[model samples]
Target: MSGTVIATHGLRKAYGAVRAVDGIDLDVRAGDIYGFLGANGSGKTTTVRMLLGLVLPTAGTVEVLGRPIPKAAREVLPRVGALIEGPAAYGHLSGTANLSLLDAAGPGGSRRTRKARIAEVLEQVGLGGVGKRAVRGYSLGMRQRLGLAGALLRRPDLLVLDEPTNGLDPQGIHEIRLLLLDLHRTGTTIFVSSHLLAEIEQLATRVGVLDRGRMVLQDDLATLTAPTGATVVTTTDPAQAARVLGDRVLTSDGERLVVRGSDPAEVNTALVGAGVPVTGLVLQRPTLEEVVLAAATGSGDRVAA
Candidate 1:
C-alpha cells in the first residue's frame, strides 16, 4: 500500500469483435477513494472485475496490492474485499446466518473465528440489533449495508465496490455515502464504480472517466471541477463593452458580455477604462456534473486550472 494499490497497463477484454474494455491504463493510489465513473455500458464494472480477477483480461497486465493479478489472485484476493453487482445472500436466512455462511465458504475461514467476525461486521454495518432478522425483511439499503459488512469481514486493505448505490433512494444513498466516508477515514483504500456523476462527486478523491470501453479522463476531483475559463460581465453600456473586449468576448446581448478565459478584474478595468460603466461581473466555475458530461461526451478540450 506504499505506492499504487491498483495498477493496470494496456488492460483489454474483448468478446468476438466487441471490446467491452479496450486498452486502458490506471493508477489507483493507496488510501485514495478512487471513483471509476462512466455511463451505462462504459466498462466500469468490467474494469473492476478485471482488478478482482473475476473476469480475465483478453490482453495486458494487472497488479493489485503490488502483486500481479489473476496469477497472484490467490495471494492477493484475500487482502482485497469486493461487493460487486449487488448483495449475494439468501433471503430466507437471518442476517447473521448469511454472513457466517459466506465467510465460512471463503478461503482461510474457520468455525472458530466465524461467529466473532459475523458479529463484528453486523455491528460495523449498523445491523447489530437486527442480526437475527430474515434477509427477506430487510430494506434495499439494509441489504446493501449487509453486503458491505460481508466485504469488510476480511478487513481488506482494498475494498472494490461496483455501483454500491445502484437503486437506493435518497436516504439510502446518503446512508451509504456516510458509511463509505467513515471507512475512508479509517484508512481503507476504496475503488468504487458508478454511472452517476453526482454520486462520485460526493465521495471520490480522484476520478477515472470511461466511455464505451475507453478511458477519457483521470485526475483529482478538484482539478476536474475547476473553473473552465468562462465569465459573465454586466455593464451599463453593453455595445461599448463589446467593442472594447474584442475577440475575448464570447457573446453579448446589449446588456452583458459573456467572455471566455479572462480575469474579472481585468475585464472590469478594461470596460471602465474604455468609458463603459461596469455594473457587475462574475467568473463562472464549472460544476462536477458539467465537467463529467463534457469529458464523457468527448467535447471538453481540457480541464481549466
Candidate 2:
C-alpha cells in the first residue's frame, strides 16, 4: 500500500501493421483504486491483458507487485485475482460448483480452507443465496457478481477487473461499486477498466485515460475533475459584455456569457471599465466526462491542469 504495485514503461503491442498500444508509461501505486478509462477499441483491454501476462507486450516492460511480469508471473499471479471479459462458467453447473472448479485450477488455495473462502466471497458479492442455483438460470447481474466472487476467492493483494459493470442494472451497478469501495478500504489495490465515467468518478482515487492507443492523461480523481476555466458571467447587458470581453466569449445568451480561459476578476474589471453592469460571476467546473471527452478528441491540451 506504499510503493508502486503496477509499473509499465514504453509499453506497446502491435498486430500486423496495427499498433494496439503505443509507447506508454504507467504507474499504479499500492492501495490505489485506479480506474482505467477509454473509448471502445482504445487498447484498454489489451493493456490489461499484457499486465496479467495473458497477452505478451510487443515492446517495453511491465511489472506487477514490484516484480517483472510474465517472467515473474509464476510468483506474481498467485497473489493477484482478475475478472476479465466476463466470468467463465459452465452453464450447466451450479454457482458453488463453478467456484470449486476454478479454485481447483487456481494456484495455492488450500482445499481445507477453500470451502470457507468461497462462502466468504459469495456473501461479499451478495450471491450467497444463489450459490446453489445453476449459473444459466441466474440473471446477468448475478453472473457478474459470481465472477467477482470467484476473483475474490484467492484473497488477492491486487484485483484487476476489466469493465466489471458492463451489463449490470442500476441496483447491480451500485452493489458492485459498494463492493469495490469495501475492498479498497480493506487495503486491496484495485485496477479497474470501465467506460462508465460516473461510476469511475464515484470509486476511483486515481485515473488513467487512453485515447486511440495512447495515454492522454493520468492523475488523481480530484485534480482531473477540478474546474478548468469554463466560467459563467451574468450581466444586465450581454451585448456590451461580449463587446468588452471580445474573443474570450465562448457562448452567450441574453443574460449570461459562458467564457473560456478567462479569470472572473479580469472579466469583471473589463466589464465594469466598459460601463457594463456585472450582475454575477460564477466559476463552473468541468465534469469528469467532459474532461475525458476533450482529451480523447484532442480538443483539450491538458485536462487535469
Candidate 3:
C-alpha cells in the first residue's frame, strides 16, 4: 500500500504454442478502483490468476502490497481478499456458518472478535438477517453479497473481484455498485475484471482494455470519454453541407453530417455561408463501447457511419 498496490513488469505466460499473456506491464495505484476489461479469451483471467499466485508466470515479476507474488503471496495474501470466477461456499451450510468457517481458518483473532466482525461484514454487505438462510436457498445476488462479506472478514487492503456482478438483477447490480463505492471511500483498493463495458464505465476510475493477449489501451475513464473535438450535425441540406465541407467532413448519417477538425464557431460559419441551415448539432463524446471497438479493430478514427 506504500507505493503501488499491484505492479507487474513484462509479465508473460504461455500454454503450449499460444501465448495468453504477452509481456504485459501494469501498475495499479493505492486506493484506486482499476477496471481490467477485455473480451472473452482475452487473457483477463490468466493475468488475474498470476496475480493471485494460482498460476505461475513464464516470465516477469509481480508485486502485490509491495511484496513479490507467489514467493511472498502466502505472507501478503492474508492482507488481500479476492472473489475470482465465482463465490466459494458450501451449499449445505448457512450463510452465517460459511462466514464462521472462513473466520476460523483465517488470521488469528479471538472468538468474540470474529463473531462481531462477521456480523459487521454481513450488515455491510446488506445481508444482515439472511445469514441464517442456507446457501443453496439463497438467490444468486444474495450469494454474491455473502461472498463479498467473506472476503471483507479480514478487512483486506486490496480486493480483487472477477465479474462481481455477473448473475445479478438490475437492483442487485445497483446495490453492488453502491457497496463498491462505499468500500472505495474507506480506502480499499479494488481491482475488478469484467466483460461488461458499461459497468466498468460507471464504477472504475481507470481502465485497461485488452484484446488477443495484448493491451490495446490503458487510461482514466475521464480521458477516454472526453469530447474528441468532433460534432454530429443534422442539416436541412446534407448534399450542400458535404460539398461545402469537402475533405474536412468525416462521414454522413443520411440526414446528418459528422464533421471533424472544426470548432463550433467555424462549423456554424461555414454552414451558414454555404446556404445550409443547421437543424440540430450535438458534440460527440466517445462511449466505452465505441472506444473498445476502435481498439479491437485497430482503427483510431471515430466511426460515424
Candidate 4:
C-alpha cells in the first residue's frame, strides 16, 4: 500500500527465437494511474499478463502489491481487479446474473451481499437500467461496460485495464474518463494499457513506453511533459518580437513565436523593452505524443525492410 503496487525486474518472455517481451523493468506505485503504452505488437499485453500472473515470464521477476506473482497469487490476486483481453460472459445470461455467478466463483463478496455489490458495480459502469437484459442483446460498448463492471465488483485496491475505453463512443469515453478520475480521487491505483495517447495524456499521472519488448521510458507524466525551457509569445508583429529576442527565438508561425527560454516574464519584459506588443505569453512543454515519439522508435506496428 505504501510502496510499489506492481514492479518487474528484467522481465522477459521469449517464444523460440522471437522475444515477445525482452528485458524490461516496470515500476507502478500505489495511487498512480500508470499508462502502459505501446503499438499493436509491442509486447504490452504479454507484460500485463505477466504482471497479473496469467502468463509466466521466461526470466526475471515480477511482484504485485509487494508480493511475488504466481508465488503468492492466492493471497495477492484478490485485491487486484482486471479487464484483460476484454470481458467474457455467457451471452444468454443477464448482466446481473453474470456478475452474481462471477462473484460466487471468486473470493470475497458473500452470497448475502451479492445483489447489492452487483447493483453497485452495474450502476458504476452505467448499466444500472439494463435490468435482466441478456448480454447477447447488448452492443459492443455495453459488453465493454459489463467487462469493466466485473473488474470493479470487488472494490479492488488496484485496477488493471487494457484499452478500457475500447468500443465506446465519444460520450461514453468521456464518461469513463470521468469515472476513472473519480475512482483515482478516492485512492485506487490504476494501470491503463492502451494506444490512445489522448486519453492517456488526460488521465495518467505516470506512463511507461514499451517498444519491441523493451521499456523505453517510464516516468511521471509531469516529468515527461515538463517545460523544455522554452516560452511561446503571441504578438501582432512576430517579426518585431523575433527581432527583439534575436537568436533566442526558435520558430515563428502566424502570430506565435517559440522563444528559447523558460521564463515567460523574462521574455515578456525583453519584448516590452523592445516595444513589441504581446498578446499572450505561454510556456512550451512537450506533448505526450512528442515524448513518446522521441523515446520509442516508430510504433509497435511499424513496418520494416
Which candidate leads the pack in lDDT?
A: 4
Q: How far is candidate 4 from the true structure (C-alpha RMSD, Å)?
A: 2.0
Which 10 consecutive residues of model 2 have the lowest summed lDDT? 296-305
Computed on alpha carbons, the lDDT of every model, listed in order, comes to: 0.85, 0.89, 0.86, 0.91
Cα displacement (angstroms), candidate 1, residue 194, comes to 0.4
RMSD of 3: 4.1
Q: Give lDDT tens digits, candidate 1, residues 1-305.
A: 57899999999999899998888899899888999987777788888999988899999999999999899988998788899989988999999999988887788667887889889888877799999999999988789889988999888889999988866788778878888888888889999999877888999999998887888888988888777687788887887787887898888877877897658998888778878888888887666788777786573432222
Between 2 and 4, whose TM-score is larger?
A: 4
Which residue segments of model 3 deviate by more than 4 Å? 108-110, 234-249, 261-281, 299-305
Q: After superposition, how far is residue 71 of candidate 2 from its true place, in Å?
A: 0.4
- Predicted model with the maximum TM-score: 4
Which model is ahead, 1 or 4, in terms of TM-score?
Answer: 4
In candidate 4, list every pair of residues with a backbone clash: none
C-alpha RMSD in Å of predicted model 1 compared with the true structure: 4.6
Model 1 segments more than 4 A misplaced: 108-116, 229-283, 299-305
| lDDT, candidate 3, 177-236, per-residue tens | 898989999899999999999898999988888776777788888899888888888887
Clash-forming residue pairs, model 2: none
True-structure RMSD, every candidate: 4.6, 4.6, 4.1, 2.0
Better of 2 and 3 by TM-score: 3
Question: What TM-score, computed on C-alpha atoms, does each candidate reach?
Answer: 0.82, 0.83, 0.85, 0.95
**Model 3 TM-score?**
0.85
